[model samples]
Structures are given as C-alpha cells and as structure tokens.
Target: MSQLDTAWPAGRDVPDVEKLIRQTREQEQQPVCAYIYDLVALRERAHRCVNSLPDECKLFYAVKANPDPQLIASLLPIVKGFEAASIGEIRTIRGVSGDVPIIFGGPGKKDAEIEEALERDVMLIHAESLHEVQRIGWIAERRQQRVSILLRINLRRTLPEASITMSGRPTQFGIDEIQVPEAIRLVQSLPFVQLEGFHMHSLSNNLDARLHAQMVATYLQCVQGWMQEYALSIRYLNAGGGFGISYTEPERRFEWNDFMEELHQVWEDYHIPGIQLIFEPGRYIVAHCGYYATEVIDLKTNHDQHYAIVRGGTHHFRLPVSWQHNQPFEVIAVDDWPYPFPRTEWRQTTITIAGELCTPKDVLAHEVDVEQLRIGDILLFHIAGAYGWTISHHDFLSHPHPHFYYINGT
Candidate 1:
C-alpha cells in the first residue's frame, strides 16, 4: 500500500501524519528541520474545491501562496489557470506549464512586466489604475499587438472586513470606483487594449461562508450596475478569492459547500450570459496538506513560564509569527538522547515554542499547553502548506535552510 493508503485507510480526516513525520526524522542524521508535503492530500483538497465550484466560476491558483515547482505542477491539471502577482511568479508558473492559462494582476506593475505579459499572451492583465491601462495600451501599441485586460476596481461600497483588506479602502491596489467611468472611456478609446472585464478583489483570509457569498453577490451587483450604466461590453467578471483557513480553530473550517449553495443563488441572480466568473484562491487550497517539522533542542523556564526552543524558528516557517497566532502543533516524542548527561524534560506544562533566532519575536507558539515535551522531541506544525516557507525570511540569522520532502504516494 502507498503511504497515503497506510496513513488514511478509512478517510481523509484521520491521517497518520505522525507516521510520515517519524519516517522523515529517521532519515536525518542531525537535528531535523524540514517541510513535508502530502501531494495526495493536496490533490484531494484541490479536487474537492474544483468540484464545489459552480459552472459559472473558474478556479485559479494564486502563485503567491506556495510557488514550489512541484506544487504548481500538481495544481495545473486541477485549476483553470494560475494567477501571478509578479513577473517572477508568471515565469515560475510558465516554468511548470508553458501553455497553461495565466492572468497577471498587481499594483505598480513595471512597463517591462506588461510587455512580458503581452508576449506571453496571458488571458488578462488586471489593470490597477487608469494610468496602468494607458501604459498597457502604450506597450501593446509599441509591440504592434492587442492586449486583453480586466480593470481591477476599488469599489467605494462598504465591504466585509478581513485580516488583510485590499479594496474598499485607501490601498495601492485597484482603481477607485468613482474614476472607473474615465477608465472605461480610456479603455474604449485605446486601440491596442481590449477591455475584457472588471477585477474586484477586496479581502484576504475571510472565513465567514454566508458572508463571503453575500460579498460575491455584492460584487456581482456592483459590476452589473456598472455594466448597465457605462454600457460596458464586458465578458468576464473576476471576483478574487479570499477563502480562509482557520488557524486559531482548525476544526471550524470555511464551509465551501455552504458557500457554493449561496453562490448558486448569486449566479442565478446576477450571472450574465457569456460572462465567466473567476476566483483566484491561494491559502485554502493547500494549507492542510503541508507540515513543518522542527526538533526541540532545549527546554527551559523563563520568568516561571516554560519554553521549548527548537532547531528552527520563524526563519523557516513564519506563518504563525507573521499572523500573530499560535499555530497548531503535535508533539512527536523521541526517546533517543545522544548527550552524556540526562535528557531534559518539561512535563505537563504550558510551553512557548520558539525558534533558534536571537530575537524574542521569533516565537512560533506562545503559552501552548503540552502533555510531555523533552529536548529530543519534535514539534510538527499543522496547516502550513500555504504562505509558510515562501513568506518566511530564510536568511535572517544565516542559518541553514530546511529540507523539503513530498509524498506523492505513487
């Protein structure tokens, strides 16, 4: 049987992740610090999301989440396309699959990046500002080519708040809703640019399923209003994704099925014929499939608070520290003690899991209660697939980078 079959015999909910972690630990000679990815789990999750999507909606993987080449390759067949925020991300996706559809979206895009996007014949360039639309037109005119684009709008309407708010506020992301009329006129006047649609991406890491559906409905309502008032002949409406992965409460996940049910109602109400809906989600797609494993090197008490310093810290997996939340972790007890002295053990205590960094801010989990933790035990961080390694500052302390391992179950 494959590792997946051995680990997940009954269902996906019950996985022997510890078995895989133990296997990875046994291979390392020194203190282990590595990232373990379950490709089977990733594919399963992607398939679930793809299956849940409505016929009007197209799923695209945002490359900013985890741009691992293997991860990108794995997601290519499952998602409709890849959404790249930078030229480097575009190149990274291209390196994985040359002809796969790509949509470039970001603020303050360079002229060269626009030219490159035109050269690549991307599905759409999400234009942030009217000036950016002008620049795209200029570059396309210079290249003697016509480029398709989606005007990314910063709508003025009140929006549901998220951890990171990209629009409906003063942000350097999209064009203001009031200025969208001028933008429409400019796009219509530009001979080299074909205005394909509108891109309204507002929130990041939004968890409420009903509220999320309502938000998408609100976006559709706003876009339809613009289409009627501006007489815009648009064929695509990109409602960017911000599906949340609950780090604080892992069991309470975002209800995609519930979201889908409400989304069907929204589609029935607002989906225009011949217009496609696109959702570019990054974190929710791959977070549960990854594990960051670090070996504990020290156990101490500072100011009557227990602490466990591991071989790696925020330098390797910085998601916990970046989001200011105690990431969920499981202790894999290792009995082998190589030291001449007795192994130090911290028992039945609430321990703060910290990395080997010199700074106090390098903690991963604070005041987390554990049954029994020792110097030789390993801490496996859960839900670390997306925005983990890619978002971390690896070279901060000039420490060694963690090893990466993938279980394809083939």
Candidate 2:
C-alpha cells in the first residue's frame, strides 16, 4: 500500500483545497510571481507530526530545495535547524539567522567551504564519505576546533527519477552500510573528532509518507543495532528529506496525518533513549507556495497541433524537463478578450508549450487541454516553489530571471 493512504488527512476533498487556491489567487497582485508562504503552512503541518511524536525530533529545513532568504528567514524560528548543501547556502542561512543549528550536507566539501563552516560554528557536518571525514578533520585540526560529524550511510535503496543515485551498486554518497564498522573505528581513532550520528536521505514525496517512515525505521534500526554492539549511543539521527509536492494538479493533496501516524508508530517500535530525531525537509515545505508567471508571446497552429510559446522556458522552471512532469498552469488574457459563450460543442486539443529560449528541448507541456488560447495571454504555472529556480537554468541564455514576490502574511 502507498504511504498516502495511511498518512494523509482523512475525508478531505479537492473542492476544499480549490477554495483556498481561488481565494489566494483572487487577492494576489499581478503580474503574479512565485510566492513561498505556502511553505509556512507545510511547516505547520509537519510541526503537528513533530509535536505528537514521543521522542525528541527536530525538523531542519533543507536549503537546496528553495533557498529564498525571505522563506528561510521565516522558517528559522519555527524549525529546529537548517541543512545546507553548499557554502553559499550556509552563508545565506547565517545571514538571516544567527547561530541557527545547521547541518552541512552535499557530497563534496572543499577545504575553503569546510573552513567557512567551521568559522560559522555549524552544529553538524554530515560527511558523505571517508575522504570527507578526514578532510573535515584536517580542516578542524588546522583551526584548533573539534567538529561534530555524522557519517552518511548508503542504504542500497533505489529511487525513481533520481538524477544522482546514492545507493545500490556503486553510489557516490556516504559510506556503504557495510563500511560503517570501519567508519566508526576511524572516527574513534581521531581525538579531535566527535561522531554524533548516522544520516540517510532516501527519495520520497509527501505522497509517500509511509515509505518515508519505513526508511526512517530502517535507518534507526541499523544505527541502534550498531550502537548495541559498540556499547555507544548517538545523540542524533539525520533522516534526509525527499518530500514530494504536486506539480501537475494543485488539487491533489498530501495526507500528513497518516504520514505522521506511521512515523510515530515506527519510532514507538524502536524507541531509542536520548537520540534526537532530525528531519531535513526541502521541497515539501516550499514547492506549493511558489508559482511561475509568464506572458504568452504568441499562438500558432500547424497540422492540427496548437502551440503556446511563452516568454519563459526550462530556463526558468526546470521540472518539466528534469522530472518530465506537467505543471498546472492557467491561461488568462492579459486584458480580457471580448468573447461570448457559444452554444456549440467545444473541442479540447493537445498543444505543445514552448519557452522563449532557442533550445528545442525547452518544451514545457507536450499535450495540454485549453479553450482556444490567444495571443497576449498570461500563463501561471502552479507549485513551482521548489527546485524550479536552479535546475535547468543557464545564464548563457542571457534572458533576465523572473522576479520573485511573496504574500506577506498568510
């Protein structure tokens, strides 16, 4: 059974969700750009789960999914910590929040990045591999400071549509589960190093809350078993985030209650004393809160195929290209076109949505249904708040980036 069946809220329908969307859209100012306040709502939902849990669990907002300064600034106070993938992201978090606990994630860490993280006094550094552990130690030794580190574990699990595979057969992230013993020995040998916990991030959307809970259970089991053998206990458990969001249909919702219930059950089954659970949620919190607004430049028809060429393309929102998923977009006339409703059979045709860029692969939607799209219309793509800004965009295209705005309060 899929996780959503058990984790989502019960008896909720699309109409209730649509009302919320329509209300937000009506009050929003135009040219409506991406807004990230929906992330706050998601955080609230996650907090419900965190608060209900028996153990001490902390949620860390992963900055890689959507690193808007304003979004991060708002979430810092609510969340326990922040997970940073790069030095720039670390800096961004530091600028907005002072001494907010941060976990330095990502595969490769340059010496300078490690030094900077050290200088900032980040709470934890998640070492992706043995080399990274030694490198961090070297940097920490140079700075005369001890660094608390977590060894990321490769669980040998496969995920669908993952760009970079981190487990199963020769993955590039963390030490293999088999290598944990050696990793522990290596950490024990270093006098200036402190081994805090084990970290694992498996791919999952909010829709698959049960799977997320199961993965977390597996991670805790492994760590607990290892600790039992070594007569040691970790202070933290970092279960990395892969919470999914609805990009195609805004009405399709995630069942958070069921997801949290499953998570609570898993933790209850394997209760560990004094180990704080840490979650790094990046996309689930921010994806729905954002939208990408573009102006329809022109419309053309060829061989019964209609095309709406917009000012923005894969350069602006990369999910259509990277994930091969359709984003829900509404085409409204910039200035209302005068038309009367005809009492005839209206036919919906499939059209290819293309971006303004020169690349042929810049197609946004291959086949979408619309009611007679015309020139000078505006298209607003929904649920583009996460992984939309940085995936397929290249500055070489030379097109100006889309302006970003946020709904101030709600």
Candidate 3:
C-alpha cells in the first residue's frame, strides 16, 4: 500500500511505544499520561506536505497546536515559519525560528502584544478588528517602521465545518464582512501601516479536499474583487489552514495527494504574480505525530453499564470531551495485575472509559468494545499530536501534570 494510505500508528515508531510500556512495567512512572512523538516520522510527514504544495503556497506551523520545545525544533527547519495567536506563542517560536518569519494573529490583542510584535519584527500582523489595525499602526508609527498587515475578513460565506469554526459570520476571530470598507480606511490612514493582503480561515478540521480547494479559489476571487474595489494591491493571500485529520473515521481522512492535486488546478485557475499563498496549519501538521497513553485504574458495572476509570481525566487530555466523540483507542494488555482483590476483566463486552475527574464530562470513550482488559491495561489514544496537551486544562483540581516524552528512534 502507498505510504499515505497506510493506517496510522501502524508504520509509526512502535519501538518507542514498546520502550514506554516497559518503563511503565518497571514502575518508572505511576499512572502516567505520556505523549510520545516520533520526530523522524514527523519530518517525513511534514516534508511531504511542504513538497505537495505549489510554489505560491508557503506552509507555516501554527504553534498553538503543540508548543512543545521538541516539536518546534523538529518543525522549525521544515516549515517556512510559525503562526502564533498570543504573545506567549510569539515568544515560543521566536526562540527557535531564528531568521525565519513569524506571523502574529488573534482578536482583541492587547497594546502590550502590539508592542512586542513590532519589537520582534513579525512578518505580518493579521488585523482581526478595525481597532487592532489602528493599534498596529500606532505601534509602528512610534517604532518608525512600516509594519506589513493582513486584513482578516470574516466573510458571509460558509463551508462544510468540522469540529470548530474560526471564521465566517460574526465570530470574534476576525473583522466582519460588512466592516471591511471601514477597516481598509483605517489601515490606509496610517503612515506606517502597509496593507499587503487578506486572511480568510473559515473552518476547522475540514476533510473534503475538493471543497477546500474550492474554498481557496473562492477566497482568492473574493479578495481580488475587494482589492480592485478598494484600489489596493494584494501581495499575499493567507489561506489560513483548517486542514483536518479524521478522529473516528480514519478511512475518510483528508487525502493529501489528492488535495494537492486538486490544488494544482485551483492554483492554475487564478495564478497571480507577487501573490504568495500562506498556509498556517495547526492540527493537520502535527495531529498524527503524537500519542496519549493512560492506564486503567478500576473496572466496574453500575446499573448494567460497564466502565473503566483511567488515571488521568479531561484535565490532561480533553479532545474527546471537546469534540464529543468516543475517541478511538488501542489496549496494551499487561500480564501482571498487582491488585490483592479480584480483578475485573471483560471480553466481548462494551465498556465506557472515563477519567478520574469528579465531573460527569470526564469520559474519554463511550461504549467501546475491548478484548480482555484488566486493571493494569494501558489505553493509547492515537491522533493526539495536536491540541492534546496544550488545549487541556492541566491545573483543574490541581492534579499532577502528565509526564511528556519526545522520542526519536530507529
């Protein structure tokens, strides 16, 4: 089978998993929820993604996905730059990107953040609001620098949404469609502000390649009309990335090769000079590179429903609760169950996996079928490379943070 078609967690660095499992057996860490990443696999996957795009498309790693130092160091050399949403993310990428470009974008940004953007000399600051543009201009004027700006427009259009939507309609993420004219005026009025392009990121975890390509084509056309109507020159078109990875339906995942193939047609349909395409993918780039593991603490059946309580709760890995999907998992059985009491084992039975949190929303997977699960069994959640740790509320109830391990190997 083709590399792209291969089932994930199959070709990944399994030796690392084995090593971690052995560590758990040795009691190196108790009830640990560890994220294991294969840097080599990530390098290969990212290289393919970067190479598949046309010359106009430049890939930027969104640091909010996973700002782990090792993750940034691995992707820093592969991607064009990092796209950050807050001051902390900007600082995180700055330490590793070196001369590579960085873009700062987020709504309701503080004046202090604007100052930091100027001091850091970001490639472009996406103006999500009219006031944000004025703030950027204010900062640039004081610094005596012409700051490049990308006007983020929340269009009136909609696409097939995944789990979340970052743009389109009246979202706090970007300026509304009707407000663009006033926004343009605000940018043009500033002496130190340079309006170079537009940023339209409408959806998150979008899986349809043809629809995604169509959205980009439509976005470019829409931007072109606005530029001509406003008499502005568009130098860059940031097709902010919402490319998706399948959490439940792995077979229905986005086809990178097919999507890029369609993108080739989309690019040719509206190829323009001096208009560099920017793709800031947060989930798709790193979602498949990391794994989250938790050990089973207890097994019980309450009111005819079987359940397995895990060591960590939504405080450590919250994607299942956020997405509201029974996350897929694999059971790594342990031969040794050190408990003195009689152990509960299930076969040909459905079980709900829940976390140790007191809240009812601490469920990880519901009604999952397993083969012979004991108290010491490990549950490894796949497709947790992005938004797994960082998105979680680790401080809830002041629980101990899970151990994080970055593994690169043969």
lDDT minimum window of 10 residues, candidate 2: 2-11
- TM-scores for all candidates: the values are 0.95, 0.85, 0.94
| RMSD in angstroms between candidate 1 and the native structure over all alpha carbons | 3.6
Show where candidate 2 strays beyond 4 Å.
1-54, 156-165, 204-206, 249-254, 336-347
Ranked by TM-score from best down, the candidates are 1, 3, 2
Q: Give the TM-score of candidate 3.
A: 0.94
* Candidate achieving the largest TM-score: 1
Per-residue lDDT of 58 in model 2: 82
Question: What lDDT tens digits, residue by residue, belong to model 1 across residues 317-349?
Answer: 988999999998888888788789988887789
Ranking by lDDT: 1, 3, 2
Candidate 2 overall lDDT versus native: 0.72
User: What residue pairs clash in candidate 3, if any at all?
Assistant: none
Per-residue lDDT of 134 in model 1: 89
Residue lDDT tens for model 2, 359-403: 778887888888756554557666677788867564747976766
